[model samples]
Target: MKMWLPVVLVSLLLGGLPATHATAGTRSCNNNGIVVLHGMPLVTVDHKCVQILCLNGLPMPKLFENANSGCCEFKNTLYAPGQVFLDGCVKMTCEKSKWKPVGNTEFRCKRCEVFNDPHFMSFDRHRFDYHGECTYALTQEQFSRTPNFGIFTEFKKCYAVPSCLHRTIFKDNPKLLIGIGYLGLNAPKIYDILINGEKFTIPGDNYAHRLIVKEEDQDVLVWRQGSCIRILGSNGLTLQQCTNSIDIWAHPDLKNKVNGLCGSPDDNIDNDFTSRGKQVFDVEGFAPQEFAESWLTPPGCPAGRKKGSAKKNFGNDKMK
Candidate 1:
């Protein structure tokens, strides 16, 4: 009798089938100290901005190249639309096809004894309007240290202080399953999804497609999907895939379809899906139930911690 065991094993290995112990390694990621996906950053696409969700965490990807260059990781995401960096310093929005400055776009210096003091984006409506609705601000003391601080009226300071929270979600499952709701710019056109440097195209009409992957040797990070990029998560609960209602409105027939894959389009800028909400993709279910009950709720980051006092904003006029 011929022993065919060795031959069978060799065939299986050469055939490239999934083995029992997958060699793909895994990594642990703390998104705002909350674990959503194990390795990659949580990126959400919207017409207005391609947000890099947890911009506060450490060991940040070469996204910004030291956070001083005013650049973020993933070119199409952060510096897309207008090719301008939205590092919290410039008050600009992605309009039509370019990064237009909403109000103030220049860095205003604050007189600070040490460039490491805590500063935040000012929210004074009058001041915002005065300063062209800029989101960056600093203390008068900090402003003093600013070069050319108070040198020009165009270079103004903010009165109302703003607040930032490390919005996060914790899940036990290390696997990540993303459901792309829509693609294209004007209409729900077909676009390609870049996963771990590989591109996969899903038809525009099909919103139920999913990019499923667990931590492994396969680098399964979504770089680009259609018109949006540099996508961080949302401040509200629901992660908006498009800039406004138009994207959802464009597809009346696919309303339910889009909702199933990426939540309701109306729930874009607002609404939180922390407790319970529609799955990003209907094909896949929610994260495991083992996630911490408290952690699953809204407000992912801890309270009483300074949110915006990072290395990017502590130096001369550097704010993002």
Candidate 2:
């Protein structure tokens, strides 16, 4: 008998899929390193900006095509609303993990990822991710150098910063789309796609990257990790498929879904530095096991939190 294998795809729509009750936020992220996804710098977060999760101590994928860790690799059962990058998604549930938090969107628990994962989205399609890493402060800098956003120090030296983590790919071929990271914007701007170098923004929304990739290769790394060129191939390269970034769903719901929050990693700016009844790390100090379906957003916002009305005042921008 002859064996027949079908070609896989590497594309994500980033929207319109069943929500996993997945809620991601961070009362504080360390002001240190950076992580690069789809050519964008995911700068180290302040203690009050947002949260990010990664799996460490695991084997790296040999080829870009094999970089898929799946959902089981997330360290500890860190699944919960307001929790950044909840783990253990496979054969997992909000009720079983007691992940869902009160007043939080069900999608927090329901979603695997609006986008692909360096941990959960494995490069080794056949292998399951065993370890993970959540980047903070200086550690994030290992990924890249250039950042769309930047700041000046008291000494007047210029510094780069990470504000968003986004990437895109094509739906048909792996060589078409590419990932682009935006550091800081002069003002709120919308997202659009460029077909053959043509600019095409989403019809109703401008959350972030559109997340377009090949369905068959969706499990692999269609796009590279650091650079944001169209994932499409050129030269001896595929000539135009796309890079891997968002999950297969990132596209279908691209126009309606929230693309996480966007904020400046400016340490000089004022952020919720203290808490009333709780200490600063109390939010991060909570254990996943201690979390329950009922436990939701901490009692109140952190102290010195940026103004809720004028986000830009504190050098913050909440991207919904």
TM of each candidate vs. truth: 0.18, 0.18
**Where is model 2 more than 4 Å wrong at Cα?**
1-166, 174-190, 205-246, 249-320
RMSD of each: 22.7, 22.7
Poorest 10 consecutive residues of model 2 by lDDT?
148-157
Scored against the true structure, residue 57 in model 2 reaches a CA lDDT of: 14
Judge candidate 1 against the unseen true structure and give its global Cα lDDT, from 0 to 1.
0.24
Instruction: Summarize candidate 1's per-residue lDDT along 30-84 as a digit string, tens digits.
Output: 4333553333334422222323332223222223232222222232244434354
User: Could you tell me the C-alpha RMSD of candidate 2 in Å?
Assistant: 22.7
lDDT of 2 by residue, 1-320 (tens): 00111112111111211122112242222213322222121111211122222213111112123222221112222223233332211122223212221232223222211111221111111111111111111101111222111110000011232111222223223244332222211111213344435554333321111233432112111222122221211111111111222222211112222111111122211211112122222212321111111111211123432211111121232211
Alpha carbon lDDT of each predicted model: 0.24, 0.20
Best by lDDT: 1
